[model samples]
Every structure is written in C-alpha cells, then in structure tokens.
Target: MATKTRVPQTIDAYLAGVPDPAAKKTLTALRAQLKKLLPKATESISYQMPTFKVDGSAVAGFAFFKHHCGYYPFSGSVVPALAAELDGYVTSKSGVTFPPDQPLPAKLVKKLVQTRLAEIGTRAKKLAAAKKTLITERITDAAVKEATGHDWKAWMRVLDKAGAAGLPHKQLVTLVGRDVESGWWRQSIAVAYEQARGKRVVGETATTGFQVGVVRTLPMTAPQLWTWLTTQPERWLGPGATLNAEVGGSYVAPRRRGNPGVRGEIRVVKPGKRLRMTWQPDGWTKPATLQLTVMPKAKGASLHVHMEKLPDADVREAMRERWSKVLAQAF
Candidate 1:
C-alpha cells in the first residue's frame, strides 16, 4: 500500500511547494515584507493559501495562480475601499491579480493592509463579543453527528491522525475551524476533545483565563451611569485609575503596590451606552479586559460588567465578589 503524503502545514512549507521559481521568489519577498507590515498579525496557511489574520479574521492573503499571482485583502472590503490606489493593477473586488513573476509595490501593499486593519477596529469589538470564549453548554455526540455527519468515535479517529490531543487549544480550534466554518461549533469540537482527553474542564477557557460577569440595574439612567463611571472610575476600577471616554484615548492605572504602573487604551466607546478597555491590575502579564454596557429599563438602566483573562479561579472569584459588592452597595 502507498503511504499518503502529508499536506504542507505552514506558510513556508506551502511556499516551498510552489512549482515556479519566479513565483516562489516573488512571494517569498512579499511574505517577508508583509511580516514587517503586519508585525502584530499571525501568519499561517489558511484556506490552503498564505494568509495573515488578526483577531481570527483573514486580513490579507496571497497565492500563485496558473498565469499570475494574486493578493487577497480579506473581509470583503479592502480592495474596493482603495480602488483609486489600485488603478493600473488588474484588480477585482475580491483580489488583485499581478504578473506571474512580479510583486505588488511594497508601499501600496502597506497602505492596503493597514487600511483593512483600521476598518476592522469596531468589527473586532463585535468579533470579540461573538467569539465562543468557553464551552459552557456542552456539545453532545448527536449534535456533532448533525453538524458534521460524523459521530464522536469517528471524529476522534480522524483527530487522532492529526494528533489533535497533542495540539494546543488554539491549533486544535483552527483544525476544527477549517472544517466547521462556524466559530461557535469549532470551539465546541475543540473543547469536546479537551474535556474527553483531560486537557480542560468545566468553568475554564483555554484562551482567555477565568471569566466573571456581574450585572445590576442601577437607580440611575444610562446617561447618569456613563457620566458617573467615566468621571470617577477610580471608585470601582481602583485608586488613581483614569478611564478616558474617547476611543483610542490613553489611560493609566496602578496595579499591585510594588509593581510598576501600566497604561491602556480604550478600544470602543459608545457615549452613554458601552465601554471596553484593558484592565491591568498586575501590570506584568497580558492585561485583562473589561466591558461595561448600560441598557435603559423602567426608571433606571441595567449596568453589566463582563471581565475576562483573570489569572486563576482565585482571581476570578475575588474579582467577582468585589464587583458584586461594589455594584450592590455603591450603586
């Protein structure tokens, strides 16, 4: 029996497999440039093409076709958004096809990808909200069969070959994402394996650390709540903490007494409605995230606080209790 060959698992491997030396050279240069352009983005082979993604959305990609190369600025809007700059290049709303042996201009490529990044700012907020951070609702084997036409045993058999058990949670999710195409279901499959194989357990998320959510209907209107919170955030956030109400505005806060102070930027701000910002109580590791929303009700508004990326259950519980007490007594 013939041994089946393994598919290329990375962008470098995929580029090495390209038959044409000219195309390979061109794309190699393009990849190097893109890495510099999108220093914060992750590079990988997505959809069997060289893709650069940020926040799990494909921001840019490129490939070799039969007669030419194509640059794909994903999210369905980048190419058209810069139609004026793309003149003289054979461009479609989907992607730009170029000469087989030549690459797109580095400056133009920078502008194109950066614009796409800026466009996805508010969209990233929605994506963060939409992402399945944890598998709170367990996915059953019958549900798996319904989604992918395969039962748990059969799915496990396939995952075994890919070494899914050994793969990290992110890689396992990506592997499932390629087949399922839905964010929530992809997480469900990955988490199912984690649970069955002892990789994780209930009340835990592999990516974001422990999470805590608290909601309270304050005896104040939405505008009143926003004004009080933004003007004097130190009361609940921490002493000497400042929350600039403008999106992209900078703020500072003290962490542990001995640790250095840290700075964070507000990500999204809908006046009198919602606010999302980074919370760095430790100022050492990645900062936690805090999302607050106010929804108008009878005489007052409901204030919701969703915090994630806590270090452990202790921190989660501590934060949960703190927020509960603050909201109950302070409001």
Candidate 2:
C-alpha cells in the first residue's frame, strides 16, 4: 500500500509548501508573528487563502502572489486608520499587500489583525443597537412643525408641489440647531406614534417609523460612513431596500413574503448628505427620516444625526439605548 502525505495543520507547514522561496520565507515570518500573537488560532485553508480561525469564524487570511503578498483582515471594517498607513502599497476597499522582497511592516500587520479579533467582542452589542434603532423609528409622531420650529406641514406641502423636493443637510442644520437637519423632528414623531399605536410598521407598508438619535464618532471618514449607513439594507436589513440617491428617486423596502418582521427603504435622500428612511417594521402612514451631517474634525469628522418625526417618551428612551449601540460600530 502507498503511504499518504499528511496535510499541514500549522501555518508554518502551510507556508513551507509554497513554490517561491522568497514568498515562503516572508510567509514564514508572518505566520511566526501571528502564531505568537494568537496562540489559540487554528490554521487552515479557507477560500483558498491561508486562514486563521479564531473561535469559529475565519478572522484573517494571507497569500503570496508574484508581485505582492496579501493580508486579509476578514472583516476589514475593524481598522479605520489602517487605510492611511497602507497608502504606499496598492490597495482597494478590502485587503492590503506588501512586496515579497521588502521587509515586512510586521508590527502594523499584527496590530491590524489583532484589532479584528477585538471587534468580535462587541458584535452582540452592535446587533442589538441596530435592532433597537429599527424598532424606535416607526412608532413615534409629534407635531413636525412645532418640534422643528418650522411650519413643516407647510414645507411638506411645498415639496409635495415641487414633485422632486428633498431636504438638504445644510438647510437642516440651520433649522434644528447648529446640528439639525430636515428630518430631525421626524424620528421623534415616529417613535411617539408607535407607542400610541402599539403596532409595528416596517414590513407591512410603503413606509414605517423608526427611532433615531446622534451617533458617536466612528473610525471611518464621512464619505465612507455615509455609504455604510445607507447601504445597510443591502447587507443585513432583512429583505433589503431599493436605494436611490437621486433627488426625485424612490426607495422601496419590500417585506419578506408572509413574514412581517423584516423590511427597509429610503423615504427621502439629499445626495451625499441628508437622508430620510424606513426600516424593519413595514407599513404605515409615513416613515421617519435619518439626517446625517458631517462636520470636519481634527482627526476625522464629527457626525451629527437628526431623526425627524420620532415618537413618545418611552420610544425615545428605547431608541437612545439602541442608537448608542448602533453608533458604536462607526468607531
């Protein structure tokens, strides 16, 4: 009988099998550092890359090609500042690389990978935040005109007439406070309405209410941050939404057929800046608005979120707790 070769179980053994000597050596050094840092990690090949499985999920991976060696922090969203440090190399939205012959920036690589592991600690908190924000935005409602210190009903009528009207972030900031926007009052109203109505609206209708509040600073830039928030329906917002950033465009969040708990949509959008939207609840008179403001800061940017037409006190309190958690993701 012929003897079978034993498959590699350690990163070192895996690297030793690579064809190129230079790539192999660099991978050896990289694997050595990762082993030292993550003693609990198990090495394996996943998606054809050398993956490090921490707990159960593949936390990181690496591979060597002809021109460069690539390192993948699976959920690359963890390290917000890593992008700048990787400026000299060729990079995209996800992975980073270093030339095989050049000395590895071992320290930075370790820091980036290690940070991803740390993020797993807060996954529960992040999910809870997202859920709570979805719930609070739909139930509340207040006199939009009074809370915003503007005759908003009149303003709505104006937009209704214009046929392509959407509120701008700058104009909103002027209305609510130094930090206000067009829909700042809407989130509050939706929350209140939900409390009074005692029903969920997300997956049942054209629009639904949601809870909203300010989000703390995140590690990403204003542009990236906005993209992430508006695009959630595409990722985890259940059946997802039809997103349109155009002025007169419409956003639709269809319900999961026969299921009433999941949905998403874009109620209003003011290109690159302000947005009004609906989330998991489905069906109602109107959806709450999410207004995102980006004020440039020294290190990054200060994000002020204005949620308009939110609901009652109970809804407000619930939403605050929820948003505190959801906002944590940005950092």
- Per residue, candidate 1 scores C-alpha lDDT tens digits across 74-172 of 544577788898989986555787886667888888998888778667555654553454333345668778887767777777788888988879999
Q: What C-alpha RMSD separates each model from the true structure?
A: 24.1, 16.4
Which runs of model 1 end up more than 4 angstroms from their true locations?
1-172, 175-199, 206-209, 256-263, 329-331
Candidate 2: tens digits of C-alpha lDDT, residues 101-123 = 77458778777776776666566
Error of 1 at 116 (Å): 50
lDDT score, candidate 1: 0.73
